[model samples]
Each structure stands twice: as structure tokens, then as C-alpha cells.
Target: MTTFADLNLHERLTRALGELEITTPTPVQASAIPEALAGHDLRVVARTGSGKTAAFMLPMLHQLLQHSRPRTDTRALILLPTRELAQQTLKQVEALGRYTFIKAELVTGGEDFKVQAAKMRKNPEILIGTPGRLIEHLEAGNLRLQDLEMLVLDESDRMLDMGFSDDVLRLAAECRAERQTLLFSATSGGNAMEKMVASTLREPKSLMLDSVRDLNESVVQQVITADDVKHKERLVQWLLANETYDKAVVFTNTREQADRMGGVLVASNLKVFVLHGEKDQKDRKLAMDRLKAGAVKVLVATDVAARGIHVDGLDLVINFDMPRSGDEYVHRIGRTGRVGGAGTAISLIAAHEWNLMAGIQRYLRQNFEYRLIEALKGNFLGPKNLKSNGKAAGSKKKKMKKKEDAKKGKKPARKKPVAKKNSRTNKPAVPDTNSGFATVKKRKNPGSID
Candidate 1:
């Protein structure tokens, strides 16, 4: 029953939340907002669609509102990993700060650089952007954070995954040393994340609301086995044709697969669009817009859309190709079952991808629901033999041979000697060339020998 008001947020922010019909604070918001308001740097690990945007934004905005100063430099900088996420955060900022006088501007790629430079000249109090474009603005002398008060690294793990660690650290360096930082990610991004935390954050309060393995509990996960890519394609078509969902996203590991799947789905007369790294900004924006507007029910995309893109009524996620890691799988399915809403995630697994899927399941510490579509079932019914850990069993011939040898008390066989070849004739001989070096001769008696 804890509410935003009990968390001591700004009146204006509470009013904004009220207008938006969000009365209660999510677990992350309730836990994080208080610490951030107390001027502590935070490292938060929460799942996607857990109101993380509000958790950091509310505290930053509350502080900014309390200590209003007339300045021409940006006071707060929120760095995201992708343009789509930047744009989405911008909308959320506008929505949350509607009643406040604080101004925020977005500077991401896919927009005119000169225009962004012009906006930077206007001196928005809050600046939100991706790392690469923000670095450009910093180097070009178009943006400055010397007087910044707060810094938020939303989706820090994704930024690191996209190879933006250096740029992010550099931008953080540009800010004032005393600035408050809030870093959030869905997964514990292993060593790279640890390195980032060491380099960027000070003595920080760590909030782990949800672990990566237990994320998206409201979404039921199921896997359908397939024979090959062709079988997966048919499975995808069948799911889109039969599955019940308001909006669904089909994830592929590569852009080439996304493009190819988009074509395959489109040819089947399905309303589908493709989004990936290679797509132009306009196309990316258009795809998201159409998906949100209900103009398209399905979107085929790469991991680019996994972290940032948020849409209501998104209740289904299909893995056209199994994601490479457990973290990536979490983000892919995170597109659906946001907040406390219910949804379903189905992954189409091929013979080659069987072990990959099993690995992800073990990483998450949860078993997926095995399903079969009778109408278009494929030959792959999973591996005949499985290890206790759920992975496909490997060949045991070598282990059995070693056990047999131990029982018989037999010594291991030694390798045969390799044949040496003569240098001139290139034939094997008793006295062979010493790796093409001539043999040396010595005399027993140097003085008497001729």
C-alpha cells in the first residue's frame, strides 16, 4: 500500500503521477527513491518494465526542483544505450515533469547534429542521450557537464554490451566530481559491469530488487523444438497466425535473420516490420511508431529493441532464433509481461540451438514449458539423451575407455615415432636431415687426423 506520496516525492511529481493514474510505487521505486533522495549514489538491479525510469527520474527531478538555480549549463545527464530508449525516456520525463518548470532535452543519433548543437546552446537543465552521440557533442565543444548535479546511467549493462564503456566513463568524467550517479541494469553484466561500477560509482547503495534468473515471472515461458531454420520459419508463421496477443515481438540473433524473417512473414500477409542496427533511424522510428499505434501487430527485430523499446499491450514475445545468453533472453522476453501484467513468451528452438536454449534455462534456474503444435510439428523432439543439468549429453566413449583401462590395469598406449625425411631426396631414411641442417663430423685426434 506504499504510495509515491509516502516516499516524499515532490508535490508536482506526485500530482503528475496522479494525473497519469500511477498511484502506488513499485518495489524498485519504493526502495530506490528514498536512498537517491538522501544524496546517495545507487547501483540498482531491477528487471525491465519495473518502473525503473520513474525510480531514478523522480529522485533526480525532486532534487533538481528543490535546488533550483538559474544556470545555462545542463544540471542532470541521463545516458542510455540506444536512440529509441533515449526518445522513450524523453517522453517519460515530459510526462512526469509536466507541472514543473524544469526543462529537459534529448541528444541522440539519427537527428541533425547541428540541430542538437543548437538545442545544447539553449542550456536545457536536464540532458538525455546515448553515449556515442553525447561524446561527439562533448568533443565538438557543443555540450558541457562541468556544473552538472546528477548523472543517471540507465541500462548501463546494455551500454557496456554495445561497447560504450569508454565513452560513458569519459562523459561521467566531464561531470562534477560530487554529482550523484544512479546506475541501473536488468542483469549482473559480469566482469565488465563490475569494472564499470568500480570506475564510475563512489560509495554507493546497491538495490537488487530482482535477480536476472527470476525476472519476468508473470510471463509464461515455453519452447517449441524445430528441425532447422525452415522449420522455425513455419513455427513462427503458425504462432503469429494462431497465438492470442495484442502485440508480439519476434526476436532474431542477427540483422540478416530479422530481414529475412520480416520478408517471410510479410509474404504470408502478416503485418510485420523489421528493426535492427542496420536499419536507418527513420525506419526504426517508423517501425516502433506503427507497433505502438497498432498499425502492426508483430515486429521482427534484433537485440537492439530488447532493452529500450516499451509498448503497452505487448503480451507476446517469440524468439524466432534463440538468444545467445541468459541475460539477452531475459531482455527479449521482457518486452512482454511488463510491471505486473501477464503475458507469454515462446522460443522456437532448432537442432543447432537446442543446447543454447538449455544453457539459458540452466542459467535462469527455471525450466521452460515444452510445447508442440500438432498441425506443423517437426522432427526435432529434443535430444534423446540429456544430462542432469538439462544440456544435451556429450559422447561418453572416451570416459568408458578410461574406465575399461583402469579395470584391466593397462598402461596407456604411447604415440608412434614420426618418420624423418632426407633433405635431397625427401624420402625417409635411417640418417635423416636434422630439420634441413647438415650433420657435423668430429675427429678423435685433431692433430693426427687428415
Candidate 2:
């Protein structure tokens, strides 16, 4: 029965929320807002679309309003892993601060650096950007955080995955030592993540709103086995034709795959847009805009480009290629089933990729239902053998090696390379007379061209 009123949000922010019809706080918002508003550093582990964005923003905005200073540098900073996320978060910030004089600006990559620098020079009250781009600005003396009051690392786990951990740590160190830090991630565990949290947050109040297993409870997760990439494409075509959906996002692992799948889907006469790291900023924005407007029914994207995509009426997510990790799987499917809406996530798994899927299932500690298409029943049914614990059986060769090594009471030494036997006799073979050396000796004797 708690509401935004109970959170003691700034009057202007409360009015803004009321105008937007955001009266009640989500579980995450309710749990973290009070602590965050109290100036305590926090680490929030919540599912995507669980209102994590507002949970951090509302409190940060509330705190920023108290001191209300117009300066040349940012008082608060929010670092996301991708440019798209930064842009999206900026939109939310603008909407929430509509009534307040607080100004927030984005400084992500893919846009003109000089232009962003120009904006930064104006000294907005808040700055949101990806780590690498922010570092670029920092090195160029365009952005500074020495007097920053608050720092929020949205999608912190993704930053590590994208290899921006060092840059993030550096940014945090450059910020004011007394600033409040908030780190939010869909994942909360991992050595690297743990190290970053320990260094960045000082005794943070950790909030675990949902576990990985329950992240997609609202989405029906299913698997469609495919023979290969081509087979998967056909299955995609079939699903789009037969399944019910408002909009669909097809996820691939690489930019090339995203482009290729987009091409395939386009050739089939389906309105599709391609999005990935290699795409130009304008094109990326265009693709998203088209998809959001329902001008395009499908969006093929790599994980990098899809981070910031949250389209209303998007009820289906298809994994063209199984993600490499459990965390990735959670994120890919998370594109749907957002904000308590019902959706479906389908993954295309080939025969060779069965073990990879099994590992993800074991990692998430949840099993996916196997669904078959009557017309396109692929050769891959499922993993042939499974262990007693329901996991895919280990490799036979690996199991044998382990058993043998255990019996020997020591590990076996690596086998040395065997020397190859010479097929020819030990004596050198006679040289060919036509090898251009037949008359070379006579000519060379006199050192003349005879």
C-alpha cells in the first residue's frame, strides 16, 4: 500500500511522477529509494524491467534537488555500458526533471565528440555516459568529476562483460571521495564484479529483488532445435508467420550474423532492421525508431546494440544463436516479459550447440521446454545421453582420462611427438639434370656469360 509519497521524494519529482501516473513504487524502488535518499551507497541486483532505472533516478534526483547548484561540471554521474542505455536513461531523467531546473546531458560515443564536448563545457547538473567515451572526455579535459556528488553504475555487470572494468574503476577513483555510489546489475556475483563493488561501494546496502532462476518467470522459455544456421532461419520465418506477437527481436551473437539474419528476413519480405556495433549511430537510431513505430516488425541485433532497446508492445524474443553464458541468456530473453507483461522467449539450438544450451540450463538451474515444429522437425532432437542428475553427460574421453588419472594416483604426462620415419633411403636422391644446373658449372668456371 506504500506510494511515492511515503518515499519523501521532492515535491516537484512527486508531481512529475503523478503526472506520469507513476503513483506506486515498484518493489526495487520501494526497497532502495529510502537507503539511497539517506545517502548510503547501494548495490541493487534486480531483474531487467523491474524499475531499477527509476529506483536510482528518483533518489538521485531527490538528493540533487536539495543543493540545486548550476555549475560547469556535473554534480551527479550515471555510467551505463552502452550508448543506447545512456540515451534511454537520459530520456527518463528529462521526463522526471520536467518541473525541476535540474539539467542532465548525455556524453556517449557514436555521436560527434566535439559536440558532446561543447555540451559538457556548458556544465550540466548531471552527466550520463558509457565508460570508454567518458574516459575519452576525461582525457581531453572536457569532463571532470572532482566535485561530483553522486555516481550510479547502471548495468555494472555488462560493463565488465564489455571489458570496461578498468575505465570504470578509474572514473570512480576520480570522483569525489565522499560522493554516494550506486551500482546496479542484473548479476551480483563474479570475482571481477565483486572486486569492483568492494572498491567502488563502501558497505553498500545490497538488495536482491529476484534471482536468476526467477528472472524470466513471466516469460515462457522454449527451445527449437535446428540443423544449422540456415535451418534456424527457416524456423524464424515460420515462427514469425505462425506465432502470435506484437513485435519480435531476433538476437544473434555477432554483427555479421545480425546483418545476415536481417538480410534473410528481409528477402523473405518481412520488414526487418539490423542493429549491431558496426552500424552507424544514425542507422542504429533509425532502426530503433522504425521498430518502435511498428514500421518494422522485427529487429535483428547483437547484444551490444540491443542493450538500450525497450519497445512497448514487444512480446517476443527469439535467440537466433544461443548466448554464450547464462547471464547473457537472461538478458536476451529479458528483452521481453518486461514490467510484468507476459511474453515468450524462443532459442534456436543446433546439434553441436546442445551442450552449450545444457550448460546454460545447469547454470541457471532451470530447464527449458523443448518445442517442435511439425513441418520443420530438425535432425537434432536433443542431447542423446544425460547424466543421472539430468545434466548432459560429460565427454567420454574426458571421463576416461579422469578415471585413469585417479587410478594412477597422479596425472599422466603429456605424450611427446613421435619422429616421422623417412620413406626414402638414407642417401640423398640424384638431382634432376634438367634443373638448370646442367651447363651452369662450365659457365660459372670463367665467371662469364658463355
Candidate 3:
């Protein structure tokens, strides 16, 4: 029953939380705040919407408040995988530091470099940015980290996935050797991730709040089989019309699909907004604003917006197209069932995508309930075949077996024989290794053998 008040946070931070109506500490904050405040590096594995941002932000802010020093350089640096996430984190930092003298700023892509560099010149106590843009500033001599006391790598897994490992590691190496490093990731284990953690964090305190399965328990996940793209569009329209929801987001794998779904939903008289990487920052920000303002009930987006976008009162998440990975599925659904909220995640699964869906379910150690609306049932019932363990059947194993059999049945390739010249010189000449010619050395007799 420990609250944010009991965490010994800065008085200003407590007041800010009170104004924000955030009284209770999330499990991650409860577990990690004390150690973080104690000046220990931490590696936290928790799901999205778990208040992990507050966990690290509060402790770092508290440390900054307790040890006030002239702002010579950035004292705390937080690196996020995406620009949106960095901006969101910067907002959190600014809000919590409102009553204090602490200065927080953001540096992300899609902005003028000179403007960002000018902001850097202000020597903010806390600097939050994406890796690529931050690297640009570092190379441009606009930012320095020699005075940095804390380094945070938020969404480490996503950063690695986006090929930012080299930049992140390089930044970490450039910082003060004794600086505290905190790595927050959703995935708990992987070889590459292990290496990153070992290189970045010291003997850090580890906090793993919940695995993917445990995180999904609070959300109701279901699948609706679609006959094809058309059928999926119909299902999406039907669900939006029939389902009860405060706000909903439909996830697509590609920007094209996101746009198409947005059009379809709009055509059906539903308020919609589209968000993805291709959209300009202005458009992306406006989309989020519209969604949050309740001006739009449906937000169609790609996976690029999955982790960064957080919406309050979002009770339904529709996977217009199924996610490719279990972690992505978890994150997409996580946008809704936040902080003990009751949420629903419905996936539109085409016939060809059943195997992919099955793999995700198997990875998460859970099965999605198959629900069909009676009036709009599609031709695809389900996967016609299933594995022994009841997962959707796939032809991959059979294809591999067939390939092996074909290779075994075929004859081995023939090896060419090495030719030798007849001593009598009757056969076509073959050159000797040492001698340039046949080395026949026209014998004393034309036909004489050597």
C-alpha cells in the first residue's frame, strides 16, 4: 500500500502528482523507486502503460532536486527509441519538474538542428531525445555529457530493433564512466539484449514485473476470422458500429493499410484519424490531440505509433491487421487495458494469416478466443488443420520434409576425371605442370615411348 507520498520524493514532485491526481505508485515505481533513489543503476522489464516512465523520472528528478548544482551541463540524459516517445517522456519530466527550478527539454528528429542546438545551449538539467538526433547534436558539438550523472535507455529492445545499438552504446561510452545507467525494456531475455545490458549497465538492480502472458491477463483478447481484405473492412465497420467503447484504436501493419482503414471508417460516418511514421510531426501531433480531445473515436496507426501513443479512456483496440510478433501484439493491446482498466482487443485474422496469429499465440502461451458475429460470419471458419497441441497447422515443417526427401532421392553430382597424356603421344596433348608445353620432347623416333 505504499503511495507516491511514501517514496520520499521531492516536495514539488509530490505537489505536481497531487495536481495530476496520481496518488498511488504503480508496482514498478513501488519496486524500483527506492533503489533508484539510492543511487543504484537499474534494469527494469515491464509492460507499456505500467507507469515505468514515472518510476525512473521521479527518482531521477528527486536526485536532481536533492543535489542542486549550477547548471553547467546536462545532468540526466534519457534516450528513447522514437521521437514520439522522447517527446512524451519530455512532457512527463516537465510536468513533474513544474514547481522546481529544474529545466527539462526535448531534442527529436523532424525539427531544425539550429533550434535544437540553441535549446541545448540553455544547458537543461534533463535532456530527453531520440538516439539518431542526439548523435547528430553530439557530433555537431552542441551537447556534452561529461557532467552527466544519470543515463537512461528507455525501450532498449525497440531501440535495438530500430538499429540504434551502435549509437546508443557510443553515447554511453562518451558519458562519464561512473554515471548511473538505467535500461528499461519490455522484452526480458535475448542474446543481443543481454550483451547490450552487460555493456550499458553495471551490477544493476533488476526488476521484471510481468511476462507477456501475465500482462495480457487483464485484457480480453479475441479474434475474428475474415475471408479477405473486404471481409476485414466489413468486420471493422461492424465492430465499430456495434461495439461499446469510449475510444478505440485500430492497428495496421503498414501505412497504406492505416490510410485505407481510416478512409473506410470515415466513409461509414465514424470519426477517424491516421497516424504513422510517414506523417509529418505536425500531423502526427494533431492526430494525437484530436484522439485525446474525443474529436475522433477511431485512430488508425501502424506499429511505429504503438509504444509511444498513450490515450486515456481507450477501452477497445482493434487489430485491423494482426501484428507480426507477440511483443507487438502485447503492446498494441496494452494501449487500452492500462492501470487496471477493462479493455477489449479484437483482431481481424484473414485465412492466410492464421498461422502467423497462431505463432504469436504460441509465443505468448495463450490462445485467442474465436468469436464470430452471426450476421457477418465469413467463409473462413478457422484453420482447417491444427497441430497436435491445437495450434493452427502450417506447411513449413512439411515443406522442409519434402525438400529433404527430394535431396535424398536425387543422384549425386558427377566429378570430372583428370586426363593424362599417352606416353606414345597418340592422344591429344596435356600440359605438364613444370613444362609449358606437353613436354613430349619429340622423341628421337616419332612414335617412341619415353
lDDT of each: 0.91, 0.88, 0.87
Q: Which stretches of candidate 3 lie over 4 Å from their true place?
A: 393-450
- Candidate 3 C-alpha error for residue 373, in Å: 1.0
The lDDT-based order of candidates, best leading, equals: 1, 2, 3
lDDT of 1 by residue, 416-438 (tens): 99877758668456566698787
What tens-digit string does per-residue lDDT give for candidate 2 at 359-432? 88888888888899999997878767888655567688987888988998986678999767776765687788
User: Where is model 2 poorest over a 10-residue stretch in terms of lDDT?
Assistant: 439-448
Q: Tell me the TM-score of model 3.
A: 0.87
Ranking by TM-score: 1, 3, 2
* Cα shift from native, residue 280, model 3 (Å): 1.3
Q: Could you estimate the TM-score for every candidate?
A: 0.87, 0.86, 0.87
**Tens-digit lDDT track for model 3 on 78-160?**
99987778877888888888899888888888888999899889899999999899999999999899999999999898888
The TM-score, computed over Cα atoms with residue i paired to residue i, of candidate 2 is 0.86
Highest lDDT: give the candidate number: 1
Alpha carbon RMSD to native, model 1: 11.0
